[model samples]
Target chain A: MTSSTSRAPVAAEGTRARLIDAALDLFTHCGFAGTSLQMIADQLHVTKAAVYHHFKTRDEILAAVIRPAVEDVKNLIAEASAQRTPTARAERMLTGWVDLALRHRALIGLLQTDPAVKPHLKEEQNASILLDQPRDLLASHLSGPGRQVCAQVALLGIVGAASTPELRELDDETLRDLLLDVGRKILGLRRPRSS
Target chain B: MTSSTSRAPVAAEGTRARLIDAALDLFTHCGFAGTSLQMIADQLHVTKAAVYHHFKTRDEILAAVIRPAVEDVKNLIAEASAQRTPTARAERMLTGWVDLALRHRALIGLLQTDPAVKPHLKEEQNASILLDQPRDLLASHLSGPGRQVCAQVALLGIVGAASTPELRELDDETLRDLLLDVGRKILGLRRPRSS
Candidate 1:
């Protein structure tokens, strides 16, 4: 009985994880608004009740699916925010941001571009605001007119290129270097002297 | 009777224009798959029959809505391709492309990023393939490794910044200059000395 009791939570966790996996695929292809609980259940070869037993609504599943990435971004931003100088902060944020984006390319792409997903991502976890903090910090490092526009477009190039599919074939490391180069140029930063 | 016949065609054209406008707005917000003809009709305060009369399917409406922009891009590419040198070609393509994206910001954004909209943009009008010609031309002008990546990311920045809502507050001319600057820097082009 005790073994069964312990196993129940583990099995439930497994099911939840699988459900999230299916939902992410569906959400990426079908979009958040278009995906339903029944579709997720069918993808899992389970019944609707089983999906409901875990996530009561599609939004609940969305929250669970994106929570890890969002938390990571928040943490990254917090770390980037603590840097002493604009250059250091932008560098840390740019590298960290590129790594996170490459690791979670499709998910990050959906989060950035999906119209239906935005409303569900509350203020603190909002992708736009999360990105804006670092972008604004990066912009502070630039001088002259239209600095904010420069920083914003440069950052978009990084996130956009990382998440975009055309560059997907470039492999993670190569793509990362390319995106970092693009970002630095747009923001008017020189390549590190050591490199 | 002849005047009435001409007026009838003009009125139909007007209705068609209005339906396309409504559909574009709906598709942008609700996503193509998530939106229904009925919802579009409701948005326009018309019967579903009215929408159906104009477009038999949502895809038809989507095609019509984006047709003008697509034609403009194709024409721009043709114009850019006619330039004598790589610099002139890249310059023409870059400037024309940014102007088109800025003019049809939301529509271009949907075309570029929306998962649901891609399949509808078939062989000739494919956004990826259409953008590739210019990117390849620009990359050829660039030397060293990762030249393609540099050009691709630079082009993405121009389109992405124009379409993204965050940078919308910058007047069109300012945004245009900033994006061109970003694109030029990444592509390793110099500021035109005469300017």
Candidate 2:
């Protein structure tokens, strides 16, 4: 997904965009349960009704905030799945997933740690299947009993690493490179040679 | 730390143990917010008053259930802190931590993912200091800007890896060795020579 900060102002200039931005800020700092429509409105200097006009519920706002990142992940999974070789798929998935995570670092942390958001992210219904598809695809690339476990941990490490506050100060390119380097080691993949 | 399953029956025999066991099961499966004292009591076929005798509230039961694992971590950190060399400390911390996570696999997942349990685990009062000590110690072992980020992600990877369901089937020796190997690589530590 494109960095929200880098996106053109037009996509982020609308009332809906404003609400999502305020809600994300509040949710990240105060947590999903701690944030309310009134809080979002207060932060935006608007009425709760103004916030409600764009999103009927907090969950709706959360879904909106997470949609872009989720879509990016879905697209990454699809692209990786199309690759014929497991090695090719692993390499592509690693680079794509790391880029997605670095681009949306805060959102990744919230998705992994926030309880209220977690159920929504892992509901096992239509949207939840999207979450599992990438993991299952990763598993297919691995062999042996430990392979699944290694793949899962490697993915967690990369995403968790990208989302760390200390790592946030690193430029995107540096952070992406370090994550890819460490992630390849975790997954037992060979590091790419210099171009 | 020893696995609760491997501990003496005395530690697992009492009404308090039964209550904690039931609570962990419910909390892990249903999410901490979804599980109640009454549900824990129901699981054990015990009266609510009986459950209350051991734990006045759900949070109390969670604290008791988490206490041993936390204590194990505290001891490990203390031992690592006493080591003179960063390499020695990293080695001790990594191996000790992997062992602890394997011993308390299910609990680590619950602590990391359960939002209700999270605040209690992270309370910055007296107990929360214990939580930060190990991380701070880990950080001291690494040098440079990326050190903190690498340390945090490496620890997350080790704990997350230890708790995976697929890895649960691997024997402890195998899991421990794999975790140490991958963990050393994550931290940029040199591989140990033959014993």
Candidate 3:
């Protein structure tokens, strides 16, 4: 057999991703608890053994799906950390965070709401660190105690706006305006958009 | 042999509410697919058999948990439907929504995220109608073309702030300001916290 048939998936476009995509679709629709290995297998038309050959269990699969999404958030934090200006950093962070959230709205939705996984997702090992990085970076430049809270709240407000299906009904332009408008308010701002 | 132990749990609390509570706790912590009846049973100090006796399957348990939360949102919609003032109705709707959400943040969190049970929670017969209530309420008051979308993004922004751990981390006063501010901005208010 060629190497393609023999290699285990560990790249951007591999069996692992395919499994995650299938699982995400099912998990999004059926629920994480509602979905099964067999279901994932069924979605892919592959054997459960084949699915297991990559992920040891469902939790591992769940973890795998969250990793890329979590990394995406981490990357945003990294970009935010790189900027020197508080205004630029805050603006970049908000835009990056919202874009990532809107792109992976489903995963962000799960992170925010899914009761069982919320804590697990936020545990120190997972997205918790990713979450804190921004807080820490923003905190470094912030002036007062309430200011940190404001920044955190502002960024989260943007994420929530981007990820919520209630917001999904919005057209892109309206959504962007709402996000930017809401962002300014959270930051205790009344600046014109072009500012 | 008197069945006293069994009777206490049965008669003292409504079985439906108990099951919903247990499932909500587990669902919030584990993600729907990750949670099991045994886990819910563990929380309730009952057996899987008892859980099954109450809910035919985990799906039913999931349904029961989201039902009340979703209904609360629907009630807000009805209440908004009765109000004549666009601003007042939006305020009333937002107020009722915040009150309802704050009461059971965890359940609302679960209903919002967690891919496992998301589909089932939307309800077949009355799907999106309850969701549309706020959008409609917003559209009635706001005359813009994408007002519906604006309303949705705003509504979600409130919900996201209300339930997020990010928001939960803030002191009550700050959290409240952020939420109200975001809401008013969504409504396109000139001064976000007038009331």
Best by DockQ: 2
lDDT rank order: 1, 2, 3
Binned by DockQ into CAPRI classes (incorrect, acceptable, medium, high), candidate 2 is: acceptable
Clashing pairs in 2: none
lDDT for each residue of candidate 3 in B1-195, tens digit (9 for 90 to 100):
221136345643465578788788888888888998889777877666767767778888877776776677777788887887777777777666656656767876766666566546554424345556776775566875446655665665556556767557766666666555555656664442655
Name model 1 segments beyond 4 Å from true: A1-58, A110-126, A192-195, B1-62, B109-126, B193-195
TM-score of each: 0.74, 0.80, 0.64
Which structure among the candidates has the greatest lDDT? 1
Candidate 1 residue-wise lDDT, B1-195, digit = tens? 111132234466677888888888888888888999999877877667767777889889988988888888878878988888888777777778778879889898676545678657657776566677767766757776578778777777677678878777778888888777777777777777663
Candidate 3's error at A64, in angstroms? 11
RMSD score of candidate 1 (Å): 5.3
Q: If you superpose only chain B onto the true chain B, what TM-score does each candidate give?
A: 0.80, 0.75, 0.79
TM-score of chain A of each: 0.79, 0.77, 0.77
In model 3 chain B, the worst 10-residue window by lDDT is: B1-10
Mark the 10 consecutive residues where model 1 chain B has the least summed lDDT.
B1-10
**Backbone clash pairs in model 2 (N, Cα, C under 3 Å; residues 3+ apart or in different chains), count:** 0
Query: What is the C-alpha lDDT profile of model 3 across A76-169, one tens digit per residue?
Result: 8888878887766766676666567667878866655554565345464454456577655544445754555555555555665576566567
Candidate 3 matches the true fold with a TM-score of 0.64
Candidate number with greatest TM-score: 2
lDDT of 1: 0.76
